[model samples]
Target chain A: MNVLEIQGLTKKFGNFVAVDNMTLNVKEGEIFGFLGSNGAGKSTTINMISSLLQPSAGEIRILGKDSRKHSRHAKTNLGIVPQDLAIYDDMTAYENVAFFAGLYGLRGKLLKERTEEALEFVGLGDRAKSRPSTFSGGMKRRLNIACAIAHKPSLIIMDEPTVGIDPQSRNYILESVKKLNESGCTVIYTSHYMEEVEEICSRVAIVDHGKIIADGTKEQLKAIITDVKDLSIELKPGSAYSLQSIGKIPGVRAVNEKEGRLSIQSDAAVDNLNRILKSLMDGGAEVKALQEEEPNLETVFLTLTGRSLRDQ
Target chain B: MNVIQIAFKEMLLSFRNRRTLFFMLAFPLVLMLVLGTALANAFSTTAAMDTVRVLVQDQSSGAAQQGFAGFRAEMEKSGFAFTDFKPGMDGAAEVEKNNYDDYAVVTNSGIKLYGSDRNAVASNMTQGMLSAYADRYNAAAAIGAADPAKAATAFQPAPSGGYVKELSLDLDRMPGSMDYYAVALTVMIALWGAMSAANLVNSEIRQGTAARLVAAPVRKGEIFAGKVLGNLAVNMLCVLVVITFSKVVYHAYWGDNLPLVLLVLLSVVVLSTSLGLALSYLLKSSASGGLISLAVQLASFFGGAYFPLGVVEKNSLLGIAASLSPIRWANMALNNMIYLGDSTQVIQTIGLNAGLAALLLAASAYMMSKREGL
Candidate 1:
């Protein structure tokens, strides 16, 4: 079942549309990636979904409840970890988690247990008594997540949860996201860092100028650009090689040699790397090093948007 | 439940803030001490007074002469210099010209006292003494007509110290400087909670924490009410601390109607917090704190926080300014309740505060609802 469904969701600030006719569905148990650069309407869409911004038009449903008509029910099932730190600096980590959890209607021993569980889940159980003022940036981010997830909502929206943290904490947050998805909680993760989205997102959507320009799995998104792959091989100096034979290999579109190095372009769909190497060996070519330039999400993004994500 | 949780969180944050603590507790306490100590003579009825010069018109014949002499002797002891009335002397004109503090006419039937309004406090005291002397003389004559035995003793004169008693406080005791400022500073500082409420609301939006709150299941009204209640709790705690400190340390008299006094103070807190919330919503959050602070300062000044409202003449610019301030209303209500056992303004004060608070809260709620973004 889809945990969240937004149809024709539009939010306009006066004459300018911050989110224009956006439509999306986040199914249960999938980690959905929402990728966009600054001023790309990504935060605006996330805010509308989280009920922080009322849509100028359109509808949002969370866990089968209309977000506007049944806001409490919708919000009760949704968790939002904003990009900025929402935890209070003066409050202890435990108090911060407990306070937010209490707002979700958790109480008594259950509240205490859930608060502790959330702190432990975030890997800050030992520092539960410590205030956020003493926490590192990464720990604060973890605590921010803990505050959102303590109520065990059906869907969690994490907006740039790992923006400026150490690699270790980034990795920890990534692993935590995976763990949360594994436990049957759907997640909508937004980030400017394409690699983070590329690593964990089961399905991805690229938004630009208040609208989604592309939406699919990473592989599918990459497939939107082209199916060509470039392979380069460096040979030993003055090694014997049959350039014509290497070019004649099936799925090899073109081949060129420069300074004892052969650059080959081939269809990305074909698995001809081993055959190419075997043919090179048979041709008496001594391969010193081999390199392949495969397409990544960044390449797909750049090819589709005509600019780097960070540039915007 | 969410409202309460949010309120609790707000209270926690407020209590932890050092600046809020200073304004709420330390600032009021210190201000009360300084103002109360520095202005003690202003509120003191026991302070030494200048001798009041009275020109008496001795129009009575021999029958009232001895009685007049006894009255004159008693008035002389209590800082009064009696000047015998002379022929063709205009006592009223002389008193008006500041040559004498008062003029009196002693006749066979009674003595009429005319006092200058410039020195109203001293004039009122002298009038009370003359009235008491007349009552004694009449009683002595009444006794002489009824029976001759007690006439001489009654007409001779009562003890010297009994003439100038504190009759003005027959209903309740007067408040001293410490007591006055204890109420003044308490009301003023309680009104300062407007800034606290503004900061509480603005900080959430400015710090980006409000998005989380807006995302929660709670309604915007809950958040607003939670903040008001939380800030009110913190401010009331500070006020109580100031009150206790003044009452215990300086022996400031808060009177017997503490519950009513606190009720008046609670209204002040409510109004102040609501004002803060309303202003924060009506204006931009960035400028709301500064505006509210400025308003609180201005109100404190014109509301007689630094001095008694009596210092400002009625219907004058300062008096009109003081009347416009909620602080003045609250201060007047509390003062009346404390020193005069008057609950008349208590109802009006609470009504006005509560009414203003209701309006502000409503406006804030409307603004919150109309707000496009969190």
Candidate 2:
């Protein structure tokens, strides 16, 4: 069953639209990955879901209740870890957790036990008394996560939790997130890194221009460009070859060259490879190397959007 | 157990943070001590041998009229400005027209000086300078009548008449002492406490804890309430520190109304909390907001903070205008603490102070609640 659902969500700043007609759902206890480019409305949509921003025009239903009218109840079971580390610099990690616990109505022994559990989960029990500002970027990030989970929310939304941190912190965060998902807590994670999304997200949503362009399981999104695959060719230097003949080959679309590297596209990707390789050798094409890539999220991304997700 | 507990935590955070400590207690004390002491000394120093400005409309512009010339020179010698004007014009009118006081001279015989009775210091100084002039004139007449030659020497204008007022009071009661300044120092000290508390709210926004808090089931109002409690705790801590400091350092008499002073100080804390909360919201950068709020506090000093209103330029509008100052009221309440034997006066002062503090708190709260955390 869906624990959260958004319908026709829209947000705008002045005349510029930041999120438009965004809609998606999160299954109960599912690690939902929200994917988009830097300005693709992922955060904006998530903000609306987390009740941080009021949607310009849309409906957000959480636990089968209207979010705006029932925000008091909806927010009760929700916890958030923002992209920026928000721990108090003057407060010890334990104190930080303790403070947040107080807000969640946890007190006395209950608060202490929760704080300890969160600290242990984040692997910072020894350093719980240390100030977050004194900790390294990774340690601070971990503490940041610890504060959110200390509340023990049913729905935990993490927005770009691993930005600008050490690799170890990033790994720790990812592992912790997986652990969180394994429990009964519902997780909503947003990131632009395709590999990370492919690795952990049970479901993925690609959003752009304030709208969700596509959303499905990894296999479902990948199957869209199943017939199209990437082909790499490394030929001798200065060998510029225009294969009008290769373009006419069955199932072949076009051939392009870049720095003596040739990439070929075809509908019958696997079957057309043998015919293309044989023709290239027949034409005396000095092929130094040849490789084929099965269609993945990156190819599906290119096929769906007509632009690489990481375009500089 | 709820938001108030979080506020206590916030208050603790303020003390734990060194920057907040300086802003909460040390900052206001330093301001009151340095600025208060300097301004108070200025007042007492100026309050000493009164400076009076008298206008003289002398119709007889001849050597015979030169009789008043001795008076003018004597006035100048004694540190008064005895200004001369045309005979037809009124002396007091001329001074009043200049816009900071009242002055005039008498046209009648027997060398009478008609002084304008308007401001306190001016009124007191004018009467003294005129009497001295009259005495000298009488001596000159006596010498001129009996033995004109010797009388010239005897004509020392009545020795600057009656410079002292006839009053029965101890010398200790004069300028009200360091305790007078200390009461106000304590109340305003809460602003620093407020500043410390305000940072807790601001830190949440800065550290992203605010968003985390928002994501929880907690309402904004509860968060704000909790924050206020935190500041109040810090304020109380500083208040205790201040009371101890006063008792230990100055043996400061806050008044017989200890509870009243505390109540008024609480109101002051609330007001300052609202101000800091509002300020933290208006400015995206807490550092900048903190600075601007401190700058605005300069208004308190100008509003009769250092000493009594009469100490400044009693002749000027601003001097009299100081009577309406909130700091003046706060100080007056505490100053009146010295005379707590008179319950009526003490209650009145406390009531007025508490009322003003409430008004400030309301205004600050209304303004602060409008602030968006983002």
Candidate 3:
């Protein structure tokens, strides 16, 4: 069963549309990647799904119940780790987790047990008595996650949870996300780092200008740009390459040369590299080094949106 | 249950903040001590004296005039000045206009003294002196009618010591400076609760915790009420400490009705906290804190919180300003209960505070519902 579903979700701030005509669904136990740059309506969509914002026109279903009609039920089933660090600095790590968990009606021994479990899950069990004011940025971010998950919601939304952290902490968070998904909690993770999304997300959706431009598995998303291959050839100093000659070659779709290096996009089905290299040598270009590039999410995003995923 | 949790968390945060503790508790106690000691003379009713100016309208002749001549001569030595009332002059009006401290009408039937309410201490002192003289006069007349020999002997030698007993008509017992400031600073500190309350929701928003809160299963109303309850509890605790400390340390008189005084103070705290919540919604920014602080300071200044306005003329500019402050309404109620033994203003003051609090809560709720951002 799908743990979350959104149908034609629309959100507007006066004349500006923050999220427009968006529809999505996350099946049970799937790690969904919600990819977008800053101000790409990613946060707005997450906010709407989390019920922090009311949609202008759309329906959001959490755990198969209409989110608006069954707000408490929907909220009870969902957890959101906001982009900003929301934990209180004045409160100890344990109190911060327990307090937020208690808001969901957790009580007494069960609340304490769950709060401890959450702290342990975030690797802050030993530091539970310490306040966040004395915590490092990575520890605070982990605590932010711990606060959200202590209630044991069915689905969790983690938005840029590892934005600015060391590689060790980032890996730990990524591993935690995987562990959480393994434990039957569906996750929707958003980040500007394509590699993070590429590493763990089973399904992906790329949002731009308040709409999803693409959605699928990493392999499937890469398949969209798989019809062409990207070629990069490094030339010796004083070497020259002719863009017009390379364009004339069969299966060579596009060609560009910059600073003694030639970049060519050609049909993957054709044997065009030899002809392209011959055209480059004919233009007095001495090839120093050459490489055949494979398409990744970055290339896929650039191909689909005509811009990099990091572009605002 | 969520409300209780939120309230407890709020209380924990408030207590952990040492700065807030100092402002709410220590600041008011120090203010009370400083003002109480500095303005001690201003609050004393018996020690501060002005000459009693009496306007006499003699409507009788013979023995009445003879008695007045003797009374005036004796009173002149002890801070009494007499003026004869002309035929067309209004003795009572002269006293009302403060042209004379007390106006006397001596007639064939009896003598009547009129005093203004503006200067109760002096008026009561004058009234006590005249009452004594009338008592002696009546005794002398009765004795002359019954036994002329005894009357002649009494008239030959007038009594000297303990003739006039001073009594306070302003209050059951007039409050000194310490007593006045004890009540004033307690209520003033209660009003400062508004400063803390103004940050209750805005801080949540600024810190981004509001998003997490809004996402929780609890209703927004519960969160708001829980936070307000916590803030009210802290403020009430601070106010009680001030009250008890002043009463025990400075020996301030809070009168016999302690519970009623507490009720008035609780209402003020509720009003101030609700005002802060309303202001937070209205301003929706960090600037709201500064605005609330400024507003509380102004109210404290104009409400006789720093000094007693007992001697201020009712129609003066200062009195008008004092009357406009909500703190003044509370002070008046407390003063009435403490000094005049009246609880009528207690009901009105609580009614006013509760009514304003309800309106503010309503406005805050409306604004919160309409607010687009957290």
**What is the TM-score of candidate 1?**
0.76
lDDT tens readout by residue for model 1, A234-265? 99987887878878888886676778888777
DockQ of each: 0.50, 0.47, 0.56
Question: Which model, 1 or 3, shows the larger TM-score?
Answer: 3
Q: Per the 3 Å backbone cut-off, how many clashing residue pairs does candidate 1 have? A: 0
- Across A1-312, the per-residue lDDT of candidate 2 in tens digits comes to 888988888888889899988778898988888877778787777778777787889899888899999987788777788898877888899998888777777888999999999999988999988887788888988998898898788888888888788888888989999998888889998765677777888987777677778899888888777668778889987554557878888877546676888877677544878787778777777889988867667667666665666561
Clash-forming residue pairs, model 1:
none
**Pick by TM-score: which candidate is best?**
3
Candidate 1 local Cα displacement, residue A104, angstroms: 1.6
lDDT (tens digit, per residue) of candidate 3 on B278-304: 998898788999999998988999898
Candidate 3 interface CA RMSD, Å: 1.1
Clashes of each: 0, 11, 0
Model 2 alpha-carbon drift over 4 Å, by segment: A12-16, A232-289, B27-177, B192-201, B279-291, B294-297, B304-309, B312-317, B320-325, B339-374
lDDT of 2 by residue, B101-132 (tens): 44544443644455444556676676776676
- What Cα-based lDDT does every candidate model obtain? 0.87, 0.71, 0.88
Error (Å) of candidate 1 at residue A18 is 2.4
Chain B TM-score for all candidates, comma-separated: 0.71, 0.55, 0.71
Candidate 1 lDDT by residue in tens digits, B1-374: 76778788888888888988887888788888888889888876666679988888887876477888877887798688999878888989998999999899989899888898897877898788888877888888899889888788878766756567786645457788888888889899899989888887678876678888888888888887788789888889888988899989989998898999899999999999899988888886478889888899999998988877675677888878888899899888887777777899999999989999999989888888888554
